[model samples]
Target: MTDGNPDSDGLVVAAFGNRGRLETAEGETLPYLLKGRRLKAVCGDRVQWKQPPQSHEALITDILSRENALQRFDPKGRVEIIAANLTQLMVVLAPTPEPDLFLADRFLCAATLMDCNPVVVCNKTDLQHNDALRAALDEYRQLGYVVVQTCAEPGGNVADLTSLLTGHTSMLVGQSGVGKSSLINALVGDAAAAVGALSDASAEGKHTTSATIMHRLADGTRLIDSPGVREFVPNISASSEVQLGFPEIVALADRCRFANCQHLREPDCAVKQATADGDLSPRRYASYKRMKNITASGSV
Candidate 1:
């Protein structure tokens, strides 16, 4: 775990509780434990650490500054940071478990707020296709979001996804039963096995099941696999900033009669006018309204 050096820098790979694995600057992987209770680390964190004397594990001492963090509201309505320094967010969806466009919208909104590129991945392409889901994906594409269709089964088509993930720190997120795990297994053949080994070694197999694990692709791409959730609410600090999540809305907001129009019951609202004129997606506008109200109320 040590190169005879007192301290070294490492990247967090799999974080569960205070114990996880970190990859050293020299590409060596070592188990790590947080130095203090207050020090919270997540996948993709660049940290300073050192091997404790008489111990085999590294002790994470300090977390380096982050470029940005992806966060969401937990069940208790508290902000929970999911990952750090993410360059791309892959929102995976499937035909099963019923596609939640609202939830997808929230993830995309969160990605936008974090300044990360968001890609919508439609998994399980071999399953019976839902026209409604197809239309929804089309709407996202029309709005300038990249939508990639993939099947995560053996020999499934994931080439496009691989291309998108190259040279980026990407995280996969979506509802349960969306085949996120399958995609991970397909993308990195040994990812599932490595996760199991790490969890077992740390005696955190059960807890790690829901933990975010980072995997490295052969091309130097880093992928963080997050547990699927039933619902996701982005931690929007203010209602005024909600419009920033919706690109189409932001583009038209400048034309609203009121400079600070919320686009709700505001006369001559360019967003409302666009919705009425069929220039903007009504469903998307409705989603924006829902998120706006949620943000204003500071709850789900």
Candidate 2:
């Protein structure tokens, strides 16, 4: 019931509360338990672990350094790390769920701030589409973001998504009911069953609903499926850095009259002028302002 070696390096493939699963360097997946309360491991984290005597589970001893992590502020203002070492963040949208453009904007902003490539995924393409939604999607495309239309049903355009996910550690994030689960199923068949098996093996079946699970594809792509959230506030350390998340704003910031323009009520602010002159999307500008405000307030 114990691994022979005293220590081994592994990748965290699933996280449910303080218990989860890890994949060994040799590609064996096993249930993992945290050694202490201080070490928190999320999906995509590289960790050091070992089997404890008389226990079937591996004990996670230390979490290795992460290149980057996707984070958000919890309701109580605590930083919650969603996943780590991600190369791409897919912000999924759909015809249904009313398409919260502001939420998508926030996700894209967070992806940019986390140093991950942000991909805009328009799921449920088989459903009806409206002009407003099309217009919003067009705005994102015009802003230099890669937007891919997808459908999770049979014969859906999942190949396009699969091609993008190849050779990268990508995470799908979006509002609840945006078909994130469906996309995962389409991309990786039997993903739900695999998750269930891992949960059962780990003896943590109840935590699967909120657990973040990573799926490995044939082409060396690792996809992390995160729990859908009704609302997500990215953890922004400073108000000024919020603009860095918006590429269009960053492009126009240099033209502002003041060197440190916050782009709110500032004289001759290029960003504001762009929004006024229809050069920038008004909704996106509004989102930036709101996020900046939230960051400044020090509370979500």
Candidate 2 lDDT, 228-276, residue by residue in tens: 7777888888888999989899999999999999999999999999999
Question: CA lDDT of 173 in candidate 2?
Answer: 90
Each prediction's TM-score against the native?
0.92, 0.92
Q: Give the range of the ten consecutive residues with the poorest summed lDDT in model 2.
A: 200-209
Enumerate residue pairs that collide in model 1.
none
Backbone clash total, candidate 2: 0
- Per-model lDDT: 0.88, 0.86
All predictions: root-mean-square deviation over Cα? 3.5, 3.8
lDDT of 1 by residue, 198-255 (tens): 4422354232346788898877789888887877878888888888878899999999
* Candidate 1 deviant stretches above 4 angstroms: 1-6, 195-209
Candidate 2 lDDT score at position 88: 98
Clashes in each model (backbone N, CA, C under 3 Å)? 0, 0
